[model samples]
Target: MKNRLMITAITLLTAMLLLAGCGGQESSNVASDESGNKTEKDSGKPKVAVVLKGLDQEYFKLAEKGAKQAFKDLGVDGTFLAATTQTETEKLINILEDLINEDPDALVVMPSTEAAIPVLERYREKDIPVILIDTDLKWDGKTTYIGTDNYTAGQEAGKFLAEKLSKGDEIAILEGVLGTDVNEQRVKGVEDVMKEKGIKITASQAADFDRVKAVTVMENILTANPNIKGIFTANDEMAIGALKAVKARNLNIPIIGIDGTSDVLESISKGEVTASVAQEPYDMAYKGVENALKVLKGETVEKSIDSSIEVITKENAGEKLEEVKSILDK
Candidate 1:
């Protein structure tokens, strides 16, 4: 009888132990679910990634500042990436691929080339929204485009030049990198306006948007057309280069450039560069992040966002320079 009682006790003890173990596991699972809920709530804030063309340029640096400000204001996590050189398409593609792997809530990109379009398509397949800034691509998958109206800005530059020079005055154009939408649209606007004004385009050449290349191309153009009255460069970098070439030759001619970079504004102050079509890169970046957040929240956004542009000349260079400096300092 004692042996039978001992065996029954052992069985009861075993059943109790098994029941306790099962109860402990259920409690642990409940705790795990609670922890997961906390994590989900904490991670509710959207994360955005911004990829620029190149960070070496002052214009992009300002845009970066603006994007940082947007992060601060909107309380979202933001990452910025860029290529070392504007022409480094392969490098840009690699950077973007890495960004895609990160699986951010949204992407803001300044495409270095149209080749970036296919790489960005990967994001679309994953349902990630993309906002394009500064430069544009020929892709239909972009969420929205935020930057200056290049064609209209170029028209403003052309009109400014045409008013200063006579109808028959010969001028030269220092074009940016060939085949890019920014270059093509700006050049087209200039050509249309110059044609309407009866301005003779004595020489036109691509400088690849490099200062050194601009110097060489300007020299060649001057050698062919010595009597060129004025020059219009696609961007401030090329404008600075063209100015260097003209200064070396001891020639005084009106030179207009786009993008009112600090260096270009200082040149304008010194009466070296005639004028520039000032683009609000900072505004573009800030708004781009804002739009990205909106899209992530399933809110409606505009298909196109123009940050606006202005004409900066010696008369307003000091004021504009101060404004730009303030933004960069922030």
Candidate 2:
């Protein structure tokens, strides 16, 4: 009877200990999103995700500001992410894959290259809205494409440069990524315009849209072709770099570029860079999110939304700079 009593006491202690251990654990607040990702418990807000090519440049920073502002004004649960650099195509693809598993209600992306199209299609299959900004894709899956008409921007910049030089005068072109669609369109636009104006393209080189690389590339071009009359760069960073090389050689010639970044606008104000075909990156990003919200709401959005472009010269560079700063400050 003593042995039986001892066994009963031990069984009772085990039951009590199990109860206490269960009580000591904390409650889980984590809940699954409608698409099965971890999310806040029953928040009425829609989940929106933005992924850019990279945020290393000032131009991309302006885009980030626009997205963040829309996030605040629209009252959605927003997540912004980016690749480390513009060239990190694989990293960007990986980010897209991870975001897909999250299954955001909508997606905004500035594609690094055409490689991102396959990953974006999965969003389409899942019925999640995809909004493309800056660099666009040919995929039918994209809900809408919001950015500048790059070819038009390039044509205008080429026209501005051609006006400063006489026919038969040779000029050089500073390209971005060699075979990328954006670079190709911009370069082709410039080339066709140059052809019409009877201007010869003496040197066409790719600096990958980097300022330092442009400096080195421009230096070599100047050494090889001393009498080149004017220059056109695919983007402002390359324009700024080329300017340094030209100044080093005491060569004064017209140079035009796209992307009316503050640095380029400042140079234009100083009468250094001749002009810039300014794209509205801010508007592109803002409208991207705005349209994404509409898609989520079952409202129709246009397939193509042109954010528009402008030509900034010394006469209006200061005003444009203030406009850009105001948007950034907000």
Best-fitting candidate, scored by lDDT: 2
Please, what is the whole-model Cα lDDT of each candidate in the order they appear?
0.87, 0.88
Minimal lDDT window, size 10, model 1 = 29-38
Candidate 2 lDDT (Cα, whole model)? Answer: 0.88
TM-score of 1: 0.86
lDDT by residue (tens digit), candidate 2, 1-330: 999999999999999999988765522434333233655633668878888988888889889888877877887677788898787889999999988887789999998778898999999999999999988777898999999888888899888889999999999999998767778889999999999999999999999888999999999999999989999999999999999999999989899999999999999999999999999888888888899999999999999899998989999999999988897773
Residue 130, model 2: Cα distance from true site in angstroms:
1.1
For every candidate in turn, the CA RMSD to the true structure comes to 10.0, 5.6
All candidates: TM-score: 0.86, 0.88
Clashes of 1: 0
Candidate 1 off by > 4 Å: 1-44
Per-residue lDDT over 75-168 for candidate 1, one digit per residue giving the tens place of the 0 to 100 score = 7766777898788888999999987876888999988779888889999999999999988777899999999889998899999999889988
